[model samples]
Target chain A: MEKIKVKNVFKIFGPNPQKIIPLIEKGKSKEEILKETGHGVGVNNANFAVEQGEIFVVMGLSGSGKSTLIRCLNRLIEPTAGEILIDGENIVGCDKDTLLQIRRKKMAMVFQNFALFPHYTVGENVAYGLEVQGEDLETRHKKAYEALELVGLKGYEESYPDQLSGGMQQRVGLARALATDPDILLMDEAFSALDPLIRKEMQDELLVLQARMQKTIIFITHDLDEALKLGDRIAIMKDGVIVQIGTPEEILTHPADDYVRDFVQDVNRVKVLTASAIMKKPDAVVSRKDGNKVAIRKMQEAGISSIFVTDKERHIRGIITIDDAMALLKKGEHSFESIINTEVPTTSPDTSIVDLLPIAVDTKYPIVVVDDDKKMLGIIVRVSVLSGILGEEE
Target chain B: MDKLQIGIYFEALIEWLTNNLEPVFEGLRTGILALIEGFEAFLLFIPSYVLIAILVVLAWKIAGKSIAIFTAVGLLLIDLMWLWPQTMQTLSLVLTSTVIALLMGIPLGIWMSQHDVVDNVTRPILDFMQTMPAFVYLIPAVIFFDLGEVPGAVATVIFAMPPVVRLTNLGIRQVPEDVIEAARSYGATRKQMLIRVQLPLAMSTILAGVNQTIMLALSMVVISAMIGAGGLGEEVLRGVTQMEIGKGFEGGIAVVILAMVLDRITQSLGNTGKTK
Candidate 1:
């Protein structure tokens, strides 16, 4: 279901932003306006919906209205026209009271410059929204404390924004957003101001949070790689319009147009892929004279549903039956390759987790990893793929 | 090379604007006529001078006890030199001018910031205003408003306005673009952004402009006396022309006193805007 929906929003700049955009939208350019009175468009026609619990990234260059688009969602720069529904309630022309209520309870934004009020301590900056929401000092302070801990900035509560490095300041900004326990987090190029190393570190931290808190986020960025890395689904914007929106894989695998394709052309798809690829067919059966105890232990170590046999030189021979291990006795000069079964099971290393599961499930043994070449890399199971995607053991 | 040209003011300037400059001197002939014609030129002087004292207190609050003491000593010197009442009248004239200049200049600056058209149009006017010299400058104020505290203030505003406008506009514009975008995203209403983000961030630069504006206004106090404006400027005028060395010294000292007091207060304010 949609969590935040924006419909036909328009923004224009003039004495009456509300009144002027339509006049301009009706084919009146800024040059024409300057020729007439003055002022021009800040944002034009826009519309989108963000899914609940999904990380939606909006990527754009400077002045592409990516920043303006996100701001419109919060009614920060009230749109000249359109409707905004949060949890199915219309907030398009929401009053200050209702708007503050929505901002306090539902939506929060992390800024590019880390926008921590410089005069405030890091802890206080985190607690600002709560304080604004009229939460008691004790409760907000406690909430702020917990938020800091979540962002791994527990001891930095008393520090000022200037005293910390750029990354640390942004961490405080993140902490401030989380302290409100917001349902939707809007990050506007939040890491763009950070140095590259810190940017990556912050990106990792965001992944960790998304893994746990599962807060639906609408992140704005100019960098396509950042969009690819953070977004479950990315919406590309240009000149105040949504150019394309889809899962990163879909966008990469099948770009909607030349614009989208060119945008993602430089991306390294290999780095984004996984293992469980190019598993070779099980080889002809050869007798495994290895004892039952050794065979059982090997099967258990592989953690595969069943164990496979290979030769001393690491060539697959045939698969061993659990019954074969049970019946087996003392070391009989056994090699797994002798027991290898000739099943030509294979998958690519870049296979996505969603597509990897069935191939792995149907396999009789652990899947082997490989590159574009026929060469074998290693193995992968359902669990490994899940862990890689989920980012942790949990 | 620029330093080599020090201790010079009028000769080169006169040479540069020889013919057009001659008509400007003719305005001095009609100075009395200009004085009679210009009425609004003498705006709110007495009360505004009182306001200046209030500002001094405000500055002292921000700047520290030392500044307050300095201000008192400066005013006392103005009093001791027997130019206290004249200083007050001049103070009134300057106060009126600076306030008007800030009012007109600041909103124009803000307008410049909000639109490309306003900026493009106003920029050249601002440039012209900034470049025109004082002796060369006072002629228009004379022609339009005539000689008096009114014309004097008008002149002072012309001389003193650009820095405040330029600085305040620049200061607001200079705020981190991201910070402004953040404020926008946070749903800050236009008024909220102006009051909170723009003004707070630009306060330092704006304060510098204001400080400069006020000092420039005070410096004009003496020049303005040529048009029948009073204050220590008149005393300096009388002291120099009458060739009373003791009178000149005291009047000069009194002018210094007024400048010291106003300068200290404003400088303190500028520093506080940035420092805190």
Candidate 2:
């Protein structure tokens, strides 16, 4: 299900915005429109849908209307024209009460600057959404604590915002947004104000939380690396219009325009490209119950140095080199278990290629990609990882 | 040619108000008098010693022990100089006018903060109210309420109300934009935003406004006394009229003592509000 759909939304900031919106749709440049009508174009025909559990990123430089576009989704900045459908309900035309209800029940936003109430304690700030919804005190408190714990801020509940560091305060901001357990989270440069190390930690924390909760999120940022790292699908905006929307790999490999190409040019591909992007299907494999002769034949036929040995469930048991398999066959070994080498390095499919660099450097055999149950999914050799970074096809 | 006649319109407006709103003026005069009389009676009913002790304790609790000691000595000096009754009268007048000012000013200020048009319209009116001599309003006050503490309080309220209204509007408007947006994003109703986010965050600034209102009200005491209001101002007026230097010094000292004590306490209150 689509959690949010923003269709051809226009946000013109000036008197008689409705009249100026037609100029925007007629392909007038922002400067031209401003010159003609004195209207500032906030978002020019923004259109996108956020699928359930997807993290959709809107990336743009300042004044590109990224923030304005995100604000329009929750009707914080009302669109001059067009529809914003959240779960199929167009909120652009919602009445004040209905808008409030939807904002309280369906969406929560985190700001670039942690917009914590200075007078409020951490717990009170976190519980604010619930309090505004008129939930009873006990439930608000309980949920507040749960949210704080989720964001790794359990005992700092009674502390004022000023007493905490900027990073800790941002955690409180995140907790406040999550306290209501709203289905969609709107993060407008939520980590842009934090220092780099803290911002990285927060990004990892959000990813961990997303894995568990699967909440639909619309994250806005100007940093290409952040967008590539965090976005399931990224929308690059320029001059109040979305220029391109694609997955991180697709964006890196095939930029939509000169601006997008320039944006991706300096990005660290090893950090952005995951192991799955470069990993190939294993050429040969041997079941653990297979005799040495079977393992040797599979490796020779596939022209591989060794064969990965797996159980009936495809759980990687070990690997057997062709030389070892031949020696075992001469000894008349019924099983290849004695020749199996268990020390080959393994990585998850989602691990960034940069993180796998050292492991790849140390291992002679192709690195195995495994799921949580240790089932072998694919293999990544050095050349594939190198070619992934070089943007070369193999 | 003929002289410009702006004063004629003013006179007509005042005449119309007097004639048509007689009952309203009477009700206001009665209400103000009753409040001042009640406060004065309460202050006098407490044994002088008990009142001093309570004030000392309140100063200590709100400001600090040093301020409490200074307050005790100041009040004792006023009593020793036989100015206790007059001081109590001044205190009562100041308190009544301030309460009235707050009652009228805060809501107006909040309304102004929400509506730019109202703020713009009243901004010059506030300037006129502030820059006009305190004695000028006494003419209308006396005409409406007839030369007594009520008229005195009316003049004081008009003189002191501007700062509170202006500051309250400023405080509410100065609440960080992001904070208000955060509240709005959380679905806070307008009333909820005002009470929970705007007002609480503006509290320190508003309390500073209150302090300014009280100080301005105190400054009006001598002017109000020209309309036959009794207080240290009457003593100062008599000292000036009769050319008695001792009496003038006593009244001047008493006024200073009261102003300092009130200023310290209210400033402390504003500071504490910010920390909370």
Q: Which candidate is the best by DockQ?
A: 2
Model 2 per-residue lDDT tens digits across residues B13-111: 989999999999999998999999999999999988899999999999999999999999999999999999999999999999999999999999999
What ranges in model 1 sit over 4 Å off? A6-49, A59-69, A75-84, A90-105, A116-124, A127-146, A155-159, A222-225, A236-394, B1-174, B223-231, B253-261
Interface RMSD of each: 3.1, 0.6
- Docking quality of model 2: it rates as medium
* Weakest 10 consecutive residues of candidate 1 chain A by summed lDDT: A277-286
Alpha carbon lDDT of residue B97, candidate 1?
A: 77
> In model 2, what is the error at residue A231, expressed in angstroms?
0.8
Off by over 4 Å in 2: A268-394
Per residue, candidate 2 scores C-alpha lDDT tens digits across A30-52 of 99999988999999888888899
TM-score of each: 0.56, 0.82
Q: Which candidate number would show the highest TM-score if scored against the true structure?
A: 2
Task: Give fnat for candidate 2.
Answer: 0.81
Q: Please, what are the lDDT tens digits per residue for candidate 1 over residues B43-151? A: 2343544644775587568778887777766665565556656766776677777877898988888777777888888888888876777766676556555566666
Task: Work out candidate 2's RMSD over C-alphas.
Answer: 13.1
What TM-score would candidate 2 get against the native? 0.82
